[model samples]
Target chain A: MSASVPTTRLQATADAFLTRFAGIKASLPGDKSLRERAAATVRSKGLPGPREEAWRYTQLRPLTDVTFETPLHADVDAQALLGRLPEIAAPHLVFVDGRFRADLSTASSMVRTGAPSFGSGARPDFDPMVALNTMLAEDGVAISVPHDVDGGTIVLASLATGQNGRAIAFHPRHSVNLADGAKLTLIEIGLGDGVYFHNPVVTVSVAHGASLTHLRLQTESEQAFVLSTVYADVASDGTYDSFQLATGGRLARAEIHATLSGPNAIAHLNAAQLLAGSQHADFTTIVSHDAPNCASRQTVKTVLTGKSRGVFQGKIEVARAAQKTDGYQMNQALLLSPDAEMDSKPQLEIYADDVKCSHGATVGELDAEQLFYLRSRGVPEAEARAMLVRAFLDEALEAITHEAGRAAMETAIAHWWDRQA
Target chain B: MLEIKGLEASIGDKQILRGIDLVVPSGEVHAVMGPNGAGKSTLGYVLSGRAGYEATAGLATFNGADLLDIEPEERAALGLFLAFQYPVELPGVGNANFLRTALNALRRARGEAEMDAPGFLKLARAEMKRLSMPDDMLKRNVNVGFSGGEKKRNEVLQMAILRPKLAILDETDSGLDIDALRIVADGVNALRGPDFSALVITHYQRLLEYIVPDRVHVLVSGRIIRSGGPELALELEANGYAGMVADAA
Candidate 1:
């Protein structure tokens, strides 16, 4: 009976989402046939539950309790939310409740709005969340960089304003394509207030000799639920560098699927999750090396205080032809309180021999000696602990190379520490 | 002034400091020389409010305030400093930032204005120069990957910057060469004045040759068995602690 509880609730949630798709299918502004197929898939499979091996550590039971409504087209004064964005000097494309707001955005020539970009990189059939996004995506951007062009920095921000105490949910489908020898730095930000569900799916394609630096900052409302999925495909001599700093959301998960389809491709998936109270966050990544001599690296750090829990699941897959693959992964968690918990799973499936693959995970409280040393230097206990926690996350945070992006991340981390202290 | 009366401390049922009594006046530097396992380091830990070393019975006062009842940071703000024997490494905390934070914390406690970053950096560089520390030392993480001598020098640098009224140096001269020893001694000597006092704990008489102490106390098995002038360190160097233990018995 206990096992059947989640199953029944999961079916109800799926039915609700399907019903939502049916109401908005005529106006969702995408491939109608594709949306129909995705809705059919959701109707059959339902939402992924605890029974699924991929989501075993992070239970979706809490999301089932909230009745999420379709976000109404209400006029939201985004001035306050705009001020909370990082002080970067780039043009921005702002989306209010997952629909593009041209008045709030600083227009960029390379970006296109008003149409959902259903790219070929994401597999809606394989992942249930991506399928849900396919069924209901209303507004997104299509960004393309020409060959050999250095398309500086651009900000993509999504703000959810749950109006009148109503729980709302939004799915934004986005796509990015970097031509050969092109470069782009994309800073994606998620911020909101009140109870809402923010589900976004992004598909990225990096052509030969191109590079894409993707930095994501997720600081949604404490009462919000965020589950985002990203699929990236890299060609020969291309690079996809990403760092996700997740410090918000009552229940959040970010899953990334990166595939290196050409030789000499590189992918770096670095993240830091700072959580407190009853917040639960999961960062899962799968790096597939399909070509010879490709390299992949991941470093995920989690700082959990109070009764919060963090999860990290990283898998490195090397195909038979992908010899000399250099893959490394490390997940570390710093549990401040005795009740805080962490779950880490590192899997490596290497069909090729002669590959250099290694992974490590460590979970510990702050070192007593380190704490004493700082306190003895006249720093108070709380400040000392915050400093030590920052130090513990330095390795993972250092992977972010963009100056403004790094500064924004530091500010977010400082705010997180401020709340904890 | 710092005074300890009938101090008895134990580490998990194993007594280390038994009925110890000592005092360092406002303008004096004293030395506590003891052999291995004689509780020299334990005394420092117990006074600095480190965890896991319990004071079963004692009354330690600093300037008429109860020291044992306060937290470590409070004691530090009260102008009490302890130079650790083995400095713990903070891998991601820069030395300059650590020093400024400590200084600002102390300043806030004392109701003084906080120093600006430029002002603090200038002051830190001057002290580091006095200790022969490179400018880049401030940029590196605190005590991480530092050589033994460099670690000792950093402790002295911290002492020089903090300028505490009373400092307890716990085996600071243990791993120093002659040159480093002189530098450390000079750093301490620069702060010696009517308002400054220190308790320099050491095992050998070598450090005393540079920074001569006003008084020397020989600790045997947890109790101070003998007390004398600077010559006591040399006497112990000649006769060894075995003779002093036998004499005390």
Candidate 2:
């Protein structure tokens, strides 16, 4: 039935998007020829329809209804914006409405960048959102860490602020390249005010023996929409560890595509979404082991309360040549209310005979025995439930190896819980 | 400190505690001994307010407060503690964290200031040493991988920290070696005082040799058929439950 539904939805919204594309296609950054060509690709493909396997869970009807305008560059007070995430004190870069606010960014001596696209080389056939970002991304940071050094923490804070009641959107293309034997920690915090769409495409390339700890804190405004796309490539013996905390946004989807392109490379993706009210948060991840002896682990946890909905779709693909590949994916959800809902789709596609791959999905309410155990110890019902919920999510956050990043993520989770009460 | 009058309860359609009349005044220890299928565990579950236990007819009171009318948490705030035969294993919850949270919650109910982290850790460490538990147990998940003896000891540790006015140890002696049993009895004996009372429920007389309850009651079916002094435990140990159960029948 959804086969025809996506086509209808796409046709209804294609005109609006095409018109918007025409206005910004010429002005988009990058080589003029590349920008125009990306726009043409977007126009030809149109937006992702509901029938598309990935776009099935997330509908675009509400998004199409909004009269989204191009977000013009507006100078912001970086100090005030920085205060929101005062716990993170590192060399930082600030972006407001997809434009870099230089006055607010701290200079880093290790890495440099030209533009950001959640890079486009991976799978161009499916994600029209990537095409959309490729056609409209204004400016993104280019970063590369030096080899054999402990590159401290780099805070990339994206703030979306707009006025005049204009429903606006911005796409920031961010690219990161870590050289062989290099090490770095990147904390990407996305926060905003007012009604807007913060669609960002990020590309990451990790070289031999290098390690990248990427932490994403998406606390967009309740009225805002966020479609974040991330594409990562890990080389021989490299490790890519990422954790995303999705606690904000009306409709938030974090789509990550990771490829272990070299032997002995590792990709660990962990995410936790604490959603309430009418909010919708979805975490979709696809990890492909294209090299022999590669390992990948993805664990996602979600806590839904009130009338919120949470969706998780995780797929592990082991190629024919990827022998001895070890892949594991688990998605767990805890529903706190009768009205709250969750959808989990865990898939394993393995063509290699010697590979080890497994996937698991579980949805449950608070354990009555655990709750009674806590309550019988004098904790009230609410606090006991909150403790269990936090503990449930903490299990997934344990995948974060970097001490500082893990602590920062824990602090963010605490804040989210505090606001929940 | 504890009182139960005609306490009748059941799980689903099956009746368990037919009619139990028991009371332990301040500064006393009472032991309820019964054979299997005597509703010993059901009594524990009903008193702890575990769901699925229906109290059809009962009147239970703790420190002059009607326990049956209040929630399990409120009963806890009144200093009622139940040491389980099988403790829960909270996978991601640290033992230290659970203890501090429970302690702080009790303190909050009494409008007292919360314990600081360092202060809590210090107290917990001391208690661990007193119970012959390793300090690393604090770092592990709450009873996640703990052995049977370790779980019961952890419960005793919690009871030691919470310092309740009335504690109900339900078959805590089950699956414990003589050494573990001695340590557990010592843990409970340390908490005994003029104000602290406990009802130690067991199926064997071995535990009584160490804890030395002031009174021993033999339960048959769903009723306590006999109650006697500490010497009665030795009598039951020598004669066994076959005689007492046959006499009750």
Candidate 3:
């Protein structure tokens, strides 16, 4: 178990147990060459480990203990498992069991094919997950927006069915490039049931003056395992806002790496994790301010109950040239049961004196006065507690602007509370 | 409407309310004027069934039902309301939503029809106007970032909406300005009726002038030492609780 070893015994076991994706990677109709290149890159470089600062808080021991394989192309009626995802009405790219299903995917008139432009060749040195995803991902959905395009949304859904016996790994790559002055809303939902594993990676690049809203909803089953990574790059004057709602899986980790590469660019990263029973969820993020005047804000909230555990590690770095950069980070956790535990670390590495940077972490229980007030108002004790918990969580959910997507997350939270009750 | 016989309560090991006896009939307002640490707030909290107030001894009955064994929410459903002296501010819970939820909970407990949204809005609007609370308070989180007067007014607003049979005003007048005090008193007076009984806990007699309690009792050293008509409040105001407690001693 050397730190630099790329492939673990578990990953080898997983590879041996499952079948590779059999879809026609060439006939995907959008950026076929780019998909092949990214897949080749990820295959060359395997998963990163604790040596990588971004993956420090979350240990991959649990994932490496079990042998997983590329999931077989199994029959999973998405309608039967999810019971009709509230009609998204926008362009949708659906992947079931790691393979794209064209019949199930509906692309809007706005979806068009074009050469991937943002960061196509300009590669950063530090992020290993990006390299791993680029090298190993078999195929992905590529969405291109023409310069100055505005007001359209794209959704990518990776769904899994537990009927497969062995552990499964899925690398659903997504390359979204926003042209100058173009605005887009992108939502990625990773959902599954039964016993399985999912490794999903999405990369987004915003052009100069472009604005993008990216949201992720991870609500897999308690028996499932997931490791997801999102990479974002913002150009000059571009704005990127991303929110993640993680409330499922036996062991789940969401890693986000964002780079403000241009002056005056802004990024808002927010996430909320609700864990109960023996569940474990982690949100690890890093924001690198490489350009002067760029700004970044990150906030994460975790609520742990039963014997569950949660981890949040956020790092914000301001380079010497990133003068006047404003960076803020806050992580708060609420432990409802004594057995529950939460670990939060907020880090700031600054190389510039003129930059404004601050970080905070808080872990505690539900406010007793708030609880008493709710219960005294006649709400049942359980419902009152749930309402307060929902309120505590609303600060994070409010960041998701998509009506359908936000509603889905809310439903997931409500269902979790109901199950606890 | 409410009766307490030899009520004994403690917090941890220290007894706060020892052998407390009180009775409030329908349509009556009883003002308990006490010196600092006289267990005035303790009595209010004990009646409302707040946790941490261990009732080691005594019987409390509200509307002919045993109150000690019930939970705080059950007490609220039984028409017992405690207007907190320092109301807790809830950041995301809207004031109107809190009121509506509380009202519906009490309604459901009493087998009454729940107030629809429109009806609730109308009632809330009228109550806010009566208390001079801005309509915007409905949109704000419950007492969050509110000034002292606004928090007190919010409590009075709850009293108006819940219409509890036994309303305990716990130091509701402590931090209010003259204008806010008048508004709060007006809200309480508006809720006064033959079916409503109130226990006003205050240090000074200033608020009593506005609501005009029917009786005033002097509470000192966790015991009521003197009982008299409304005039007793003015006397206590003129002489202060020190003189009254010294005279009683």
Report the error of model 2 at residue A107, Å.
Answer: 2.4
Candidate 2, residues A136-251, lDDT tens digits: the string is: 77778887787777787898889877555788888888888788998888999998777888888888999999999899999888888899999999999999999999998999
Looking at candidate 2, what is the lDDT of residue A259? Answer: 94
lDDT of 2 at A53: 82
> Which TM-score values does chain B get in all models?
0.99, 0.98, 0.97
Candidate 1, A229-344: lDDT as tens digits: 99999999999999999999999999999999999999999999999999999999999999999999999999999999999999999999999999999999999899999999
Q: How close is candidate 3 to the true structure, as a TM-score?
A: 0.92
Candidate 2 residue pairs in clash (backbone atoms < 3 Å): A112-A142, A113-A142, A116-A140, A116-A173, A116-A174, A117-A173, A117-A174, A118-A201, A118-A202
Candidate 1, A95: how far from true, in Å? 1.0
Best-to-worst DockQ order? 1, 2, 3
State which candidate, 2 or 3, has the greater lDDT. Answer: 2
Residue B82, candidate 2: C-alpha displacement in angstroms = 0.5
Tell me chain A's TM-score in each of the predictions: 0.99, 0.94, 0.86
Expressed as tens digits, the lDDT of each residue in B57-165 for candidate 2 is 9798887888887778888899999999889989889999999999999999989999999999999999999999999999999999999999999999999999999
